[model samples]
Target: MSVVKGLLYPLPLLIGFACAPSALGAFLKDSKLNLNLRNFYINTDYREGHAGTSKAEEWGQGFRLLYESGYTDGKIGVGVDALGLLGVKLDSGKGRHQGSTTLTSDGDHAADQWSRFGATLKLKASKTDLRVGTLMPKLPVLVFTDTRPLPQTYQGGMVTLRELDDITLTAGKITQVTGVASADRTGMAVAGGRRQSNDFRFAGVDYRTRDNFLLQYYQAALEDYYSQQFLGVSHIWKVTEGRSLKSDLRYFRSRGIGANAAGEPGYQIAGYTPDHRGEIDNDTWSLAFTYAVGRHSFMLGYQSVSDDSDFVHLNQGSLSGDLGARGASTYLIAERLQSYFGRAGQDTQIAQYSYDFAAKGIPGLNVTVAHQDSEGIQSFAGSSLRERETDIILTYAVRSGPLRGLGLGLLYGELNSEVTPDQNQLRLMVSYNVELF
Candidate 1:
């Protein structure tokens, strides 16, 4: 929970120079600046009791500014992208500021403020682009986390090509990541590793059909950690005028790599698995079906993880010194509030229902409820471990007047687990965005 000072000081200087009309030539004329004002609050009540603390709650205000410059007038266009973030603590005391969800702890107390700045250099040529800097990538294999006030960011270089119709190719190398609650960047690691790996490289391709079919494949490797491959497919079939069904399938395979496979105990991941092997050998797959009728949608899914190892993803808890960071996320729908449901030999079933109020003359409003059940976790022997979670979310947006770009969201979740503590969580957020030229 160490906050990096002076990390965002360069942002104001860069903004000052870039915003000057006379300095950037055509870059200034075509640039776009957007600012988001966000207010967030979270409350977590530990049901099993949290060792002298029963609840953790915090509230904060966040500011996110993004500036993107259009490609300069040339065959090989060049531009710069910058991100500026600032978070202000609105309310938090010693007992409630344990860094559960909202704010990072600083010497037994939450920090008063935190800020970060990042910039990207870009080059574009004939529908292809290369960018080297901070990025937030949302892919099947690696998705950035944005569940909190500020989104997570990664330091890396990526190349994207879309020269072919209905297809996209991407590749990147990421060395470090900055978590949502911290200003400092750390090396990448799995759930429980004593060290970090500076090398996390990936490549992928996505192909889509005109008839609403998509296919994807990606491969990634974290040096001395694990090598992972992902495959996904999605298809949408229209049943009638206002009815449709979507089918989504995803799979992942992970195994130890480099030192992780060299029989060295120091390279192994940290977690409970079959026989306490702590190795990276797992296969997981999930399939989901969704049916939509007018403004209503229903979804069901099933997921299975292998019996030898837990599902793996890019996690950095090992770099936090005390191993206290628990803010890891993935694209899996089974990742609930208290658990990822990714333990070895786990099978998960999910159901969801959502409705849009626009059809009922209440535009800009939506509600969703979901439930997930997971069983057969290896951590609990004998009768097999089981966990269940129920979540509800509501969102609304201002569609007119002075608050046209304002939005509000609320979420509530409850978790019951056989091997872990049962808990309840709530989050409320309000956001507004403005464009500055």
Candidate 2:
């Protein structure tokens, strides 16, 4: 079914439960509703006219209504969750509507509006829970992108177990994804693979050591595409009052599977290295360190991708040139605007700083600046490929009054690359959240 149909498929159930509240008194008593209003504007000026375009820009307003219900009172409790999303174009022209980034394309222009809705059925038993249906998952092995007007969601079943102290286990299977600007669901595909896969499976374990250390391990597979494993660890130590140090480490290994390994026609990924092996084979690692004292924080990080291929992740854009159904994200700290620093043989270094004006008695205000430099990207072939990006961000929120939940955020970024397009980007966002009983 299409996203619209799937979203509306459960409306009757919601209406029935709402009408007969007495039949599910527990659910009604624990149910909660929240609505979020968001306005977003984005502009990108291509310094060298990459993608054969001088600039891309779009502005839109979004509304999201989320309803979550508490489980019924029983050893095996049942509940439901619903999400409704609407996006209206405020300003977007054909010249600014780049495929799969800001808005869905309508021929050479952008669609006027788009909407989607979804529901999840959930069951709970003791400390474990089972959820089946539309989901937004944030796992080490897989993450859903939500940087646009609407967040991406998946059709799947997920189970979580928290029976053990200090440890949690999670498992899931995903079949389809609904993009942020889409009214239909699409199968899963990798960055360069043209063929879509309906099966993506993952399992993971998370362990906490004491109160300041965490360890994670996860395995994932995209059928006939690639199999991946990830391991991560993080720790924080308080050196003194209002002072601390932190460290984060992550690693990933990917290898081709089935058809991809067999070199089936139209099954190869894009940007393979050294004679176009055309198979998924990569090993990547990243480490980051941070220190914070008073109102200031600083970070230094490094990441390196294997020489065989670019760091790979699920990217629906490979299937088409439309901006509506294309979204992807990664856990790499080096990931920045328009680039993940993930090209084959790439090595990236990062520096960042942030401050909270609350320390200066100005509450609800913060500022951050960051820079990343990368080299040795294999895409340049015989020539050396290097890139750099600088970004600044500001954010604030209203603390009280009728607009207590209102927030504003601004981001400006400049990127220069030897092997890719150079660009300047800006983003302005405003949001308010309200709860309805």
Q: Pick the candidate with the highest TM-score.
A: 2
lDDT of 1 by residue, 1-437 (tens): 12222444465566454344444577666888788889999988889935757888899988888888876666777778888887888999998877534666677878887777889888889999999999899987778888777878889999999999999999999988887777777788887776778899999999999999999999999999899999999999999999999999999999988887764665667655655667889999999999999999999999998887788998776665532233678877688655777877889999999999999888999999999998887773443688899999999998988888899999999988876667899999999988866
Residue pairs with backbone atoms closer than 3 Å in model 2 (clashes): 99-323, 100-322, 100-323
lDDT of 2 by residue, 1-437 (tens): 25335444676586465344554778667888788888989999998948667999999888788888877777788788999888888999867887756666678888888887888888899999999989999998889998788888899999999999999999999999887777778888877777779999999999998879999999999999899999999999999999999999999999989898888866677874666757888999999999999999999999999988777788787775453568788888898767788888889999999999997887889999999999888763453588899999999998887879899999899999887689999999999988876
Each candidate's clash count: 0, 3
Tell me the TM-score of model 2. Answer: 0.94
Instruction: Pull out the clashing pairs in model 1.
Output: none
Model 1 TM-score relative to the real fold: 0.93
- Kindly report which residue stretches of model 1 are placed more than 4 angstroms away from their true locations once superposed: 1-23, 49-52, 263-266, 322-326, 380-383
Give the C-alpha lDDT of model 2: 0.85
Look at candidate 1 and tell me the lDDT of residue 283: 94
- Assess the local accuracy of residue 382 in candidate 1 as a C-alpha lDDT between 0 and 100: 42
Error of 2 at 196 (Å): 0.8
